[model samples]
Target: MKPQSMLFTIYGEYVRHYGSEIWIGSLTKLMGEFGLSEPAVRAAISRMLRQGWLESRKVGNRSYYSVSERGKKRLEEAAARIYKVETDVWDGKWCIASYNIPEERRALRDQLRKELGWMGFGMLTTSTWISPNNLSDRVKELTEAHEITEYVEIFTSEHMGWSNPKQLVQKCWDIDEINEKYKSFIDAYREEYEQLSAKMSNGEAVPDSHCFVEKTKLVHQYRKFLFIDPDLPQELLPELWLGKEADELFQNYYQLLNPGAVRFFETVYEAAPSA
Candidate 1:
C-alpha cells in the first residue's frame, strides 16, 4: 500500500476517535510499525497537504495533522464499502452511461473512467459503462464534480432480448480473477484469524505491539477489496461466492482485533511526549 493510503487507514480507522488529529510525533511512531520511516511519513504528509487531503495545526512548535474535510468525506465513503455487507436483491436493472470527452482533455477522460470503476461501473464499450447497482446519483455527482455535464448520457434499462445479462458479466469484469484474490486473501489470513478468534474467545489479552501490527495488516487487506470488488448483486455473482465467505472471515476476525487495536492505539497516543 502507498504510505499515504496507509495514513488514511490510520486516520480514518482510529485517529477519528481522538478528534481526527494526530501529532506528528504520534503519527511517526505509529507508522513505524508499518515499516514507514519518519521522513517518508513527513513527505507523504506534505504531499497530502498540497493535494487538499490533509490539514495541519501548530501548537508551540509542535504540529498536529488531520484529514481535510474533502478527505474526510472520501474516507467515510470508502468506509461504507469496506465495512458494509449486504445481500442486495438485484432488481434486474442496470445503470448505463455513455460519455464523450475531447481528446485534448484526456486527463479528465481518464478521471471519469477511473471514478466510474471505483463506483462499481464496468465498461460495456469504450464509451459506455454499466453497473447493477443504482449509481445514477453517483454518476451525476461525478459529472457535476468534473464539470462535464454536456459530455455524458445516462439511462437505466432492463434485459429485454434473448441474450442474458449474466453473459455480459464476464466480459465487463474478471470474476475468475476476483475469486482468486478472495481465495488468496482468505488463505493468507486464515491462521491469523483462527489464533485471534481463539484468543478473543479465551478472553486473553493481546500485546500492544502485536495488536498494532495485526490491526494495520487486517485493515490494509480489507481496504483492498474496496478497489478490487465491484460488489455485484448475488444473482449476478457465482454461486458460493468466495467473496461472501471472505467477508465472514474478515468481520469475524476484525471484531476480535478491534478492542485490542483500540487499546494499543490509545496507549500509543498517550505515550507521545507533550510539546
Candidate 2:
C-alpha cells in the first residue's frame, strides 16, 4: 500500500478499536504488526493530531489521544463519501477481462472484486470478468488502484450481456437500498439531536462523555454504508472513482472535526455528488 493508503488504514483501525484514545505502547504494537517503523508511526499520529483528527490528554507522565467528537463525525462523513451510492446508467459496450490468478492469490482476487464493486464493477461472471455500464475512466482507475494495470485486459464486446433490465436494475439497486438504510439512521439521529438540544437549552449538564454518544451516533448514522456488497470482490475498486471532489471531501471531513469546522464539511458533504 502507498503511504497515504497505509496511513488511512492505520488511522481507521485506531479509530475503530480505540476510538482515538490510544497510547504509545498500543501504537507501537500496531506499527510492529503493520511493519511500520516507530518514527513513521509517530509521525503519522502527530500529523493526525495536528490535523484535529485526534485529541491528546496528558495525565501524570503519560499522554493518550482519542478521536474528538469532531473527529468521529468527520470519520462518519468520510465513510459515507467513500461508500456512498452512485446512480449511473450502464453503457453496455465495455467489459472486464481477468486472467488466471494463482491459487495462492485467490484471496487477493476476492479483494479485487470487492474493490471493483466499490468502484462500480458489476460481476457478470465469477472469475472471468466484471464491468460497469460505461467503462471510460473507471477502467484506468481499476488498473492503477489494483496495481494490475498490465495484468488485466479490457475489451469492447457484447459476448455476455445482461438481457434482463429488471434484474440488472435490481442488482444495481444495492446503492439505493443502502441509502434507504442510512436514511432511517439519519432520521433517528435527528430525533436525538433535537432531544439533546432541548436538554442543553434547559441548562441541563451535558457531560464530557456526551462526546462518546455523539461519536456513536455518527457511526450508527453511517454504518449502513460502510461495507461493499459482501458478494462482490474487494480489490476491484476503481481508483479514479474517488475523484478530486472525493479527496476534497475526505480532507474537508478531516479538518471539519475540529470545533468550528463542522459547517464547512457539512456543505461539502451535501454538495452535489460527482458526475
Candidate 3:
C-alpha cells in the first residue's frame, strides 16, 4: 500500500477503536508499523486536513488530529456496508435501471455508471444495469444529484429467462476473481490466527507494534472486497463458494488477533502516561 493509504488504513482500524483524537507523536510511532517516515506521514495528515477529512488542534506543545464530522459520517456509512455479514434475503427480484444520457454528457454518464456498479448494479448492457438488491431510492438520489432525473428509470422485476441463473450471475460478475481475493485474505491471516492462538494458550505476550501492524494489514486487505464484490446472496452464488469460507476465516481470525492488537494499540495511542 502507498504510505498515505497506509496512514488512513491504520486510522480506520486503530484510531477509530482507540479514540477519535490522535496525538501526532503517537500516530508517528504507530505508523512505524508501515515503515513510513515522519515526513510522508505528515504529508498525509496535511492532505487529509486540507480535504476536510481531519481537524487539527494543539495540546500543550503536541498536535492532535480528529476525524472531521464529514469524515466520521463517511466512515460509519462505509463500515455499515463493508462489515455487513449478509443480505437479509434475495427477494427473488432484480432492480433494472435504464438510462439515456446525451453524448455531450458522457463524463456524467460514466460517473453514474461507476457509482451504480459500486452500489451493486451489474451491467446487463451499456445502458442498463441490474441487481438483486432493492436500490430504487439509491438510484433516485444519484440521478437527482446529477440533475438528470428525466434521463433514468428503474424497475423491480424477476429474471424470466431459462438461461441458468447461475450462468447469468457469472456473466454479470467476475465471481471467480472476487473469490481469489477472499482466498488471498484467508491464506495471509490463517497462519497469524494459528500463531496467535498458540500464544494465548501458553500465556505469551504479543508485541503491540506487531499486533497493530498485522491487524491493520488484515483489515485493509479484506476491506478491498467491499468495492469489488457485491456480497451477493447465497442462492446466487456457486456451490462450495470460497467467499463463504473466507468470511468464516475472517471472523475467526479477527477474534484471535483482537486481544494482543488492542493491548498494543492502547500503549501507543490510548494508554495514560505513568505517574
User: In TM-score terms, which candidate is top?
Assistant: 1
lDDT (Cα, tens digit) per residue for candidate 2, span 109-219 = 776666566544555566544554444455566567567665566666653554543355345435445445544454445555567557766987655334332432343
Q: What is the lDDT of residue 144 in candidate 2?
A: 74
Q: What are the models' TM-scores?
A: 0.92, 0.43, 0.82
Model 2 regions lying over 4 Å from their true place: 1-100, 128-147, 155-167, 172-180, 183-190, 201-205, 220-224, 229-275
Rank all candidate structures by their lDDT, best first, as comma-separated numbers.
1, 3, 2
Give the clash count for each candidate.
0, 19, 0
Which regions of candidate 1 are displaced past 4 Å?
199-205, 270-275
Off by over 4 Å in 3: 17-19, 49-52, 55-64, 102-107, 142-150, 270-275
User: Candidate 1, which ten residues in sequence have the lowest lDDT sum?
Assistant: 266-275
Q: How accurate is candidate 1 locally (lDDT)?
A: 0.85
Residues 26-94, candidate 1: write the lDDT tens digits.
Answer: 899989988899999999999999988999888778888877888887788888888886767999999
Q: Clashes in model 1: which pairs?
A: none
How close to the true structure is residue 37 of candidate 3, measured as C-alpha lDDT?
85
lDDT value, residue 203 of candidate 3: 91
- Ranking, TM-score, top scorer first: 1, 3, 2
Best by lDDT: 1
